[model samples]
Target chain A: MNINEIRNAARRNAGHVRRTPLLTSPFLDEIAGRQVYVKPECLQHTGSFKYRGAHNAISQLTTEQREFGVIAFSSGNHAQGIALAARQNQTPATIVMPSDAPQLKIDNTRALGAEVVLYDRESGDRDAIGAALAEERQLTLIKPFDNEAVIAGQGTIGLELANQAREEGIRNAQVLVPCGGGGLTAGVALALEHDAPDLTVHPVEPTGFDDVARSLHSDRIEANAQRTGSICDAIITPSPGQLTFPIMRRLCGAGIVVPDEDCLRAMAQAFTRLKLVIEPGGAIALAAALFHRHQIKGDAVIVVVSGGNVDAPVFTDALNRFA
Target chain B: MNINEIRNAARRNAGHVRRTPLLTSPFLDEIAGRQVYVKPECLQHTGSFKYRGAHNAISQLTTEQREFGVIAFSSGNHAQGIALAARQNQTPATIVMPSDAPQLKIDNTRALGAEVVLYDRESGDRDAIGAALAEERQLTLIKPFDNEAVIAGQGTIGLELANQAREEGIRNAQVLVPCGGGGLTAGVALALEHDAPDLTVHPVEPTGFDDVARSLHSDRIEANAQRTGSICDAIITPSPGQLTFPIMRRLCGAGIVVPDEDCLRAMAQAFTRLKLVIEPGGAIALAAALFHRHQIKGDAVIVVVSGGNVDAPVFTDALNRFA
Candidate 1:
């Protein structure tokens, strides 16, 4: 997606996606020894940044596509995003969710007026089921992070962050973003690079699934089918997507890998000190900053907290283990 | 304090206190059949509305008084609020905390550069120790409630809520505020009554310790010395404060009582649906709206979530009980 197109998408969806606040923290700054601003998407609708993508994608659909409805395969924030977006657009939506997924998510998606089809992750094929349903019903398939509209939609967060920071008298600063399939990070990097080329953008990845870091070093896409289930479940993707990696490589500086324990510790700190309920994935970028991942130094920095959809038990366990 | 004085204090402390967002929930609206807006003071600095009163009290201190330092006795959000506000004002602060208070709170107060003096709740004389310290050190005592400056500071939330509702095109809405010593409820009620007299204000009290509610009905302060800690630790005050009860009686329309179990259920629902970390006391008004008192029918109704400084284990247990 072009930078101008992404900016227009951001403008188009401004009313739909929350203009999530950029909050400054003296406590976080005292720890990092720099001024820190956080773009809190954890407080976004559906409790994640995925709402922007889903809302933007649904808005861009043709009348025929809207009439036929939409389908997607996701067991988490993306599912809720699609469900809420479709509900707002008065379109029918079908979501294929793994049976073992958290019941809170399933209930939320269903509550948003979406039809949820459950498939056992151990034995059932979610993608195949979703694809079949879409084809059989002539519904449009809205890919979670791979489509151009989705990328452009996610890029709006970066644009807003840059503008907000500039308005806050931060002419130049480092921006940190957590990476899953690299869609959010790539979109943000592209937007920031085009709008504020002087600003440095850093991608933070979970340690066990640091495929993006490895890919940057090897100059190619790297995949890891195994070794999932990091503490940061929200961003535990097996590989970086083909479209996202190239964009990230062209726009971002370097990727940083942070341990799962650090993410949990950051999560607890955020909850206790900042009063923000952040999921492990959303805390990773702040964790990287807290642990000092890069050799570079700055007077100001921004961390993108991407989501807050953590199961109560899982969140408690993480807090107990780290706090 | 007069309503005009309280309004002036609120204006003076505007930058210091977060004009916390008033969030609308379609899901909550669907469930209650009324428009629900949540004023999330749970996201305030120090995780509570105590910061507002603390800031206001400290700002009014004389130069000599500030030099002698400030002293407060509490086992909850009050300690953190006093410590942070004192630090910001460049004054020394001494806090007397119960031995059984959460370690996180103790650490946070200490980190904010306050001298935390621990006393045994079972054996040690809290009031005597506090008085001795104040007299010996010549420190200014900042009471948690029962003070005009503090009550005025807490009233800022109401001012912001009224402004926020106006921005959202909502006029003459009903608002519910949880009452402990009645500082928050009284301050908010005074502000709302002054700015928008047509608006109705409801104060929610815990079922077992409904001293404020009883006092409002009887036109006199009441006591329940035997009552303590069934749940909602933040609002377990033994009696209503003399400074706040009269204001509540004058401005508040009615008082609503909510059960402990209902508070837990509201906390769980807030986590699952709105993705907010609200303490038991913070969820009381919402609990009242959801279960106990459903007679509040309006085009728009706002619930003030007072704080989010919950102990992790207690939070986990509450979630499990409700979920």
Candidate 2:
């Protein structure tokens, strides 16, 4: 994807999306030992930046394709994003999700006007279920991060933040983004490369699921040994997407890996300092910015808190432990 | 304070203050049964709207007075606001706080570069101590809500949100503001009277501390019987300010009083739906918008969540019971 595509997507997504605020606090700056700017996509529609991709992708569809509707397979932020975006576009949406996914997610997707089809995740193949459903309903399958339109949509954040950085008088900095399938990281890296050449992008991942980091290190695609049961479930893909890895490999700096505990602490810090409720997966990039300060350069750092679709118990636990 | 004063405060606050975003969600709209717009002053500097007034008041001080420094007596949001604003203007601030105040507030004020003077709440007279200290140092005393410049500063929110509401296509609506000493409510009421005439302003208070409501009803100033023991400490003032009450009496609609439980529930709801951390006092306006819809008159309602500096245990309790 190019700047033109991101610009086009931004134009299409204009009124329907929120240009979420860039947040900062002196308390956070002291903790990170530098100026820390936070791009809280959790404040975005559907409480995640995934809505940017979902909305853009839906907008990119042909009238006939949109009339036929769209299908996606997700049990978390992506599901809600697609559901809400499709509803806003007046396009029917069907989300194939794991039966074991949190009831809150399932209920929220349904509430957003999407038909949720749940399959057994342990034994059932989500791809097959989504494919069969798509074929039966003549629906276009929307990949969360693998598609070009979605990546371009996510790149809009890059374009917005580059200007915001300049407004804040930040000349050079590293931007840490949570790495799931590398869609957000690659998109941000590419946009920053074109707009703010002095600013570098880094993908931050959890220790056990650092596939994007390993892939960049080895100069090839890498897969995680284990996927399920990660605290950061929103970012536990098997590996980096085929479309996203190459852009990230070229444009991104070395990846930053943080532990789950640090992610929890970051959640508490977001609550205490920013008054934001961030889920564990969404807090990892912030964790990297605050905890992995030794690996970073520049006097300022920007972290993209990717999402905030977390349960109360999980959030309270974080606050209790750290706040 | 008049429109001219608010306009001047807005100009003074242009660069240093954040014009915090107006947030809304379908979920909140569904709960309120109307389009609900939230002005999260909880996201403001010092995690409250108090910063606006503090900065404006400090800036209003004469160069000689500013050089001599400023002083205030507050143990909560106001203390931190004054501390930060004073530091930003390179003016020394001395805050006389009750020794029994939460350690977090005291520490936060001190961390922001203010000198903390602790006094006993039970026996020691805070006014006497503050007056003595001010007399000794020749420091200008900044009242929390009674000062003309401070009220004008708070009025800036009304000016900002008036334009924001019109942009959202809201021609007529009610603005529910958390009422402490009525500074925010009176300021916003005055500003909206000029800028957004169709939008009425209402003061929201907790049940026991409905002094503003009683005073508005009686057409005379009234004081609360209870002095302490409130879940919403931020808004536990005995009565409205002499200056602010007159303006509130003229411009404000009937005051809306919510029970402490509803405030707690609103806090949990803000956390769950808005991904925002709101203190009990700040959540009262939102609670009125959701639970007291019958008392309101409009197809849309705007609520200002004024602060978010709750302790962890209290927040966790709200989550545990309601979330």
Q: Write the per-residue lDDT of candidate 1 for residues A23-55, one digit (tens) a residue.
A: 765677887778777787878888889989899
Q: Which sections of candidate 2 miss by over 4 Å?
A: B120-123
For A46-128, candidate 2 gives per-residue lDDT tens digits of 88899999999998788999899999988678899999999988899999887766666688899999999988866888998
Question: How many Å off is the CA of A322 in candidate 1?
Answer: 1.7
Q: Which run of 10 residues does model 1 chain A get worst, by summed lDDT? A: A288-297
lDDT of 2 by residue, B46-134 (tens): 89999999999897778899899999988578899999999999899999987877666788899999999998866788999999999
**What C-alpha lDDT, on a 0 to 100 scale, does residue A39 get in candidate 2?**
95
lDDT tens digits, residues B1-323, model 1?
Answer: 66777777877787677667766557777766777888888778888899999999998899999999999987778888999999999999999988877776788789888999999866888889999999999999988888888888898887887787777777777788888888888888888887777677888888888888888889888986544565676777778888888788788877888888888888887776566778888899988776754667567788999888877776777768775
Looking at model 2, residue A283 earns an lDDT score of 98
After superposition, which runs of candidate 1 have C-alpha atoms over 4 Å from their true positions?
A23-36, A118-128, A194-198, A292-296, B1-7, B30-33, B119-126, B293-295
| Top model number, lDDT | 2
